[model samples]
Target: MNFELDEELINYKEKVRAFALKEFTEEVARTHDIEEKYPNELRMKALHEGIIDFMNPWKTMIGIEEMCRVDPGLGISATVPYFGAEVLMLHGSDYLRENYLAKVISGEKMMGLGVTEPGGGSDVAGLKTVATKNGNEYVVNGSKMFITNGTIADFFVTLVRTSKPDDPAKRHRGLSVMVVERAFEGFSSNKLTGKLGVRATNTGELIFTNMKVPEKNLIGDEGKGFYYIMEFFNISRIFVAAQSIGIAQGVLDRTTDFLKKLEASGEYVGEERKFKLAEIATRVEASRLLMYKAASFLFNYKPNPTITSMAKGYASETASFAAETAMEITGQTGISTDLERFFRDSKIMEIWEGTSEVEKIVISRMILKGEKNE
Candidate 1:
């Protein structure tokens, strides 16, 4: 058995890489990163050019890797418009599928998932956002924090508590997922600026002050929203792993170029530098293998939490490691370059989707519970 990408995937990867190189220029990346601006024009161009296809998960995964490899902020901005459509696809009703999915898929509208709330870092069950059902509508209140595509998205797949739990220990039992439209009365968002990395992507806090969301917008069963969101995370963590792999790889590429120039100038290129490259390269390979392994289980209709967490956790830390190593290897040059941006961007990979700590908890618990795959 071999571990080569099929001709189809290879060709597609090259196509995306070429598009990124041609269109996502250094000037554009630097400008966006420095100005803390969302790359809407680039996003529109990528959509029109069909550089990102959300319908196919594998393509989406590969496209993210290739685009991010060039510039993390711009790449992430361009590819993040359909951030939460998976929830609608997986658990939404026929009406949602026909109405919302088509618009998002056509790139006519943007979307995001709202799971993290103010004061709720990764504790989804501990969310304070509540949606009170009234007749045929749900009046949503409370706020969501650190929502990607927040200010720009036409709607959001938001999680909220639908009722008080019978048991104090079962807060998750009352949690539910529903779609909240931007045009809804009492719905507002505050743009969050000055991010450490991924400055080109939109980030904001969503406030729902007595906003009335249609009851029909609820995804799946009422109490099962938590499970659905968890399942989505199990799937999404793979993509996060992919994103981390991309950052690591981009750092590796730039660092390699720096080293080559040093060697060309007859600067004393030591074995230590060579070994560092080897280590970064090896970790990148291992992260890719882990991501693919996790994706194989997920995309094939079998979700493996242990493997997925392992991939997401290890890959994110690997990204940080690669970026820091690149900084160390390039020294002063790294500071004067975009590798600094990549270094900053590498950090969030360990924080979002699931923190490195969260992922470790997931991995350890799964293995100890005897749910690990052989």
Candidate 2:
């Protein structure tokens, strides 16, 4: 089987890498990380440079990888302006697409996704946010915690409980997705600072107390929000896998460079360090292949959740592993250099989108159900 990117994709990947290396400088990344700020200027610049291509999922995946390789925080910040556009593209009404998605695509606005609640971590079906239908509007009263781009987004594709499920055991029912604007009355967000990593990407808590949403904002069927969100996750998990692979690859690159510098300076690098480096390289390559396999299935519209979960779960773990191993190899030098930032940044890969535990659950459940690989 051919395992190479097409000529066009290869060129685009190089272009993205060049753009990232030029823009995502050490000083810029350090400032954003230290200040816990989002780089809106970089976002706009990438947009203007045509680096943010959503039409081609391959380009999106490659761009994410190359950019994050340079600097995870700035890389994510530059590309996260359209965080929840998939929901709109797949399920939203024409009006929603024309008015909202169009603006986001044109760089006129930014968006976010609101799913996790105050007490909800990986329990997506257990969200407490509720939206009550009133006339032609829905009055929403609930809060979302750890929402990406929460404060800066012009709107959010939010999930809320529309009705109580008749069956207590099946609590995933009666949920709905809708677009909630930041300008709406009673809709407020508190920017959260001091994140463990990816500090350049905005995070906040969304509070909606009697926030009114137009009925037209509803995406797809009223009770199909859960399925829609799940589908979105299947797509997003691939990108997270890409992000994880990038971080792992980045750590490997830095560690290899450090070892080379030591050897060039007449210092003998130990076999243990060489073995660790080799293992990191192997894991990075494996993670990339898994991510590509998952992406192939997903981009073709025939998603295999087992493979996708496997890719994301394994890649995230690899990223953390590579960073930690690099630290062990470089010791004090690694701690003092920018590799320290990568060490901090690699951790969120295991926690966001779907946790490693959650991915394990998905893979095991799918396997037990005898889901065939397509």
Candidate 3:
């Protein structure tokens, strides 16, 4: 497959680079890092610039990679608002699209995806959140942890169980997804602090205590939430890979600069340094290719499950490894606040979207299925 980006995509990348460099300045980045505050102004700017509406999953992934290459936190701030809105844009009702998409694109309303709960992280089917039907409203009672953009989201695309235990033997069939507005009487959110990284994204917890969600808020159909969630993950996993690749690229750029400066001063002796640089570059390129392949699959609307899993797993692992190499190359300077932040941030990429272990399991399952079919 051709790995080179077309002229149009290259032009798009250049535009993204220019915008990110201008809008996400080092000073602004530091402020967000120090205060653990979300970059709302920057997010609004991105929305106005149409960066938030590049609905093609691949293009959005590329845009995110470019912005995050400069600053992960800034990138997160720019794209976090799109997480829930994208689901609605792709699969939501007409009323949902008209009511939410425009406001989300304009930054007037923010949204979040609530899938992970305090009870389980990777075991999504084990979620304890429940939404029981009333006359015309669904009464939701549950709490979600580690939700991105939760503190500021005007609404959430929440997963809940709507079926009884004896309804079916299928583990994921009883679940349903709903849109819960923050204005509901029993809806609340609390900001979570002291995070390992991505401090600017405003991680938080969402609580729905008998929140009355209108029947219209239900997405698709009851007992199909797992499928929708999986579908969302198919797209989201690619973006997560993009984010990881971006961080890896950032670390590579910084390390290359440092190596050039050090080599110029004759501080490093021999081709060992050169060899290490070349190796790191090779790894970075491979990771980028995997990410692009995953994006391409998404663009074609083909479910390349193995490729997606490989992209997410490999990109994340490569990022973590690259960060470690960067630290080794930069020595004590790598431990500085900036590099350390990247180091810390790279870890979450492997764990979120799906853990590295989960990715492995997904890949293994695909391989086993293929073999059985043969």
Candidate 4:
């Protein structure tokens, strides 16, 4: 398989690297993590540089991956909103796209995805948020938990149940996707602080208490929201894998640099550290290959459920493992303020988007499906 990126894509990657180096200094990265503040300015810079509007999902994934290599929190703050806009572009009506996509791409408006509820995590059909139809609007009720950018988003792409519960088989049938602005009546958000990682990216709970959303705000067709959401998940999971891979790469790079310095000063190669570093590097390379395979599937628009799961599972786990190794190698200095933040941040990569257990389930399902087909 040809692994070389095209010239245009290579140029785009270079652009992203230049922007990150110029705009995302070590001090800025530290302040973001320490203060748990959103990187609003950096996000705007990314928008202006066209990193947010870069059309190809594969390219966008790579760009985000590279950005996360610098700082995962900054990368999330910079790219996650575009994921929402991408949903609108792919499934919303022309009016919705016209109104929302440009603003999102321009960074004038921030958007968040709302799917997980207080009780629902992996079970999309189990979401409890309700939306009752009115003449020209829908009245929404219920809250979304653990929403990224929830506290600061200008608009939210939300999934709500419109059908009754009596029909268990039809639960996924009557779900609808709609857009709700933060300014809507009865809509509110509160920030969730003290997170273990990615603290610079805002995470919060969004409450919709009889909030009214315009009829035109509906995404795609009515009752097909579940399918659309699933499709979105297929694409988005790959992005998360890329982000995790980038984080792992970053940890690996730092560790390698640290190891080299230690070796230069005759500290790391003392027969004890050799095997540990070798093992960690091997695992990191495996994770990178899995992530690249996932991206290849996405780039070709091929169905690769197994590869996607493998990518996310391996990359996230590798990120954590690499961070742990880095800490071990660096000893007290790694746990100190200089490197401890990255280690803490790396842990969350395994938990968010989808947990490692959930990824294993997905991979197993795909394997079973393939076996049955054969």
Give per-model CA RMSD.
0.9, 0.7, 1.9, 2.0
By lDDT rank, best first, the candidates go 2, 1, 3, 4
> What stretches of model 2 exceed 4 Å from their correct place?
none
* Residue 308 lDDT in candidate 2: 95
lDDT of 3: 0.84
Worst 10 residues of 4 by lDDT: 365-374
Indicate which candidate wins on TM-score.
Answer: 2
Which parts of model 3 are misplaced by more than 4 Å?
A: 165-169, 371-374
TM-score for each of the candidates: 0.98, 0.99, 0.95, 0.94
Better of 1 and 4 by TM-score: 1
* Top lDDT hit: 2
What shift in Å separates residue 123 of candidate 1 from its native position after superposition?
Answer: 0.9
The lowest-lDDT stretch of 10 consecutive residues in candidate 2 is 75-84
- Pitting candidate 3 against candidate 4, the one with the higher TM-score is 3
- Per-residue alpha-carbon lDDT of candidate 1 for residues 303-325, written as tens digits (9 for 90 to 100): 99999999999999999999999
What digit string (tens of lDDT, one per residue) describes model 2 on residues 244-335? 88888899989999999999999879999999999999999999999999999999989999999999999999999999999999998999
Backbone Cα, N, C clashes tallied per candidate: 0, 0, 0, 0
In the range 1-374, model 4's lDDT, one tens digit per residue, is 67677898788888887887788788998899889999888887787778764577767888987888877888878888765665797889889987887777766788889998888887778898999999999999999999999899899999998777557776788898999899999999999999988888999999999999999999989888888887777777778877877777777777777778878987645655667777778887787677777777767767476787788888888878878877887787677644576788788777776789888998898787773211
**Clash-forming residue pairs, model 1:** none
lDDT of 3 by residue, 99-157 (tens): 87677776788888999999889999889899999999899999999999888888888
| Model 2's TM-score against the true structure | 0.99
lDDT (0 to 1) per candidate: 0.91, 0.94, 0.84, 0.81
